[model samples]
Target: MRLFGYARVSTSQQSLDIQIRALREAGVKTNRIFTDKASGSSVDREGLELLRMKVEEGDVILVKKLDRLGRDTADMIQLIKEFDAQGIAVRFIDDGISTDGEMGKMVVTILSAVAEAERRRIFERTNEGRYEAKLNGVKFGRKRSIDRHNVLSLHQAGIGATEIARKLKIARSTVYKILEEMKVT
Candidate 1:
């Protein structure tokens, strides 16, 4: 079977040294190494695309981790299912997972579930923080561009949005929004 190695980093600024070295030491051909430096939220990554184009049924695609393939469990599972459907196997070097095998498939599913649960926890914590902030009377958003008197005078003058923006030294959108806010208040 053709062994294809996929190396990825979450951001363009990071290096792929570790993943590449691991794949090479594992006996993956240098020519088969595909690299991508993009967020895991993206499914159509450059390296992934290259690997998909090169690999055929019975070929193995190797990754550093399941997260390197996707941001959450759903995406990871979808990708695995797609590869399985094509009769292509995905192997996670770090996790020792292989879609070609039974145990590896189960491990990937478990890891993906954990990742999804962790993502949910993070979101829940963020929401809780926001709720506490609201309870403490802490205003969110742009925080009232200027005071009441300044905004009221501008609105009363019936000045055009552009003129108000120029006078306030803010963007036209901000000026219009302020005027809208004034009307509501």
Candidate 2:
């Protein structure tokens, strides 16, 4: 059976070095490793799609952690079922779990539930923090790119959206939005 390794981080700001290192330490070749810098909730990740196409029957896919595969239990279970049907096995490095046997399948089901619960806890905590911040009168979202006065002044000066965007160092869409807000030409 061919061996493949997958690594993923939720954002570009996060590093894949740790996961890659772990995969390499497990004897997976660098060329056999696939990685994605995307949230687990996203289904259009290029790296993951490529890996799915590359895997074949009797292939073993290795991941450093279960979260690297996905966070939603239903999605994870569906993916595992697909792999199981294809005679493919998935092994989590840290969890010491593999989908090659009945016990492993049971553990996967339990762990998927735990991962889903953990994701819910994280979501709840984030919302709680946001609620607390709003109660404290902390403003969020991007500050105004330019004040309304400046936008009106620039619009009246015959500045087009492109020029206004360049001068204000903001997106052309933002310039148009500012103009639209003031109902000015």
Candidate 3:
């Protein structure tokens, strides 16, 4: 039987030693270990893809945590379902549950629900912030600093756009844009 281990860290600086050791201690072969440093926020991971390609029926896929699989529940569930479709079992080291067992499926389901809840909460909070900003008369975009007075004054003084931009320490295109905004030729 072939067992493949998958390990992920949010950044390359973080160590994958813990997961590697845990998987090896769990009886996975050293040559079968696949480790990477990538964000768990999404499923578009290179390491995950490599594991998917190599995994076959009855293969065991190991990880450290549920979140190491994904940041959202749907993504986590999708990952599990992919393993399910391939008949590959997911063994979480920390949780000590293997998808090949009934208890493991229950744990994965619970964790997936929690992840979905967190994502929904974040979405609501973001919407509330935007709404509050609008109600408080606070602009929710980049502030406009076209310098209307300077542009109009310089243009009225018969200054060329290029020279005006140099004087203002801005770009020539910025001068032209200002002129356009001011309805000046």
User: CA RMSD for every model?
Assistant: 5.6, 8.7, 5.6
Which ranges in model 1 have alpha carbons more than 4 Å from their true place?
10-14, 65-67, 70-77, 139-185
- TM-score list, all predictions: 0.61, 0.59, 0.67
For this target, which candidate reaches the highest TM-score against the unseen true structure?
A: 3
For residue 65, model 1's alpha carbon misses the true position, in angstroms, by 4.3
**Candidate 3 lDDT by residue in tens digits, 97-172:** 6777677678667766876787899899999999998999988678876677987798899998888888888889
lDDT of 2 by residue, 19-133 (tens): 9999999988899899999888765678888888999998999999988887666677667778878888999999888998888678767866876787799899999999999
Candidates ranked by lDDT, best first? Answer: 2, 3, 1
Clashes of 2: 0
Candidate 1, 1-185: lDDT as tens digits:
98888888988789999999998987899999999888887787888888878888998888887677777566677787778778898888887677777876676577668767878998999999999999999888886656656655876777776887778787888766766766733
In TM-score terms, candidate 1 sits at: 0.61
* Per-model CA lDDT versus the true structure: 0.80, 0.85, 0.82
Candidate 2 ranges with C-alpha deviation above 4 Å: 108-185
The clash count for each model shown is 0, 0, 0
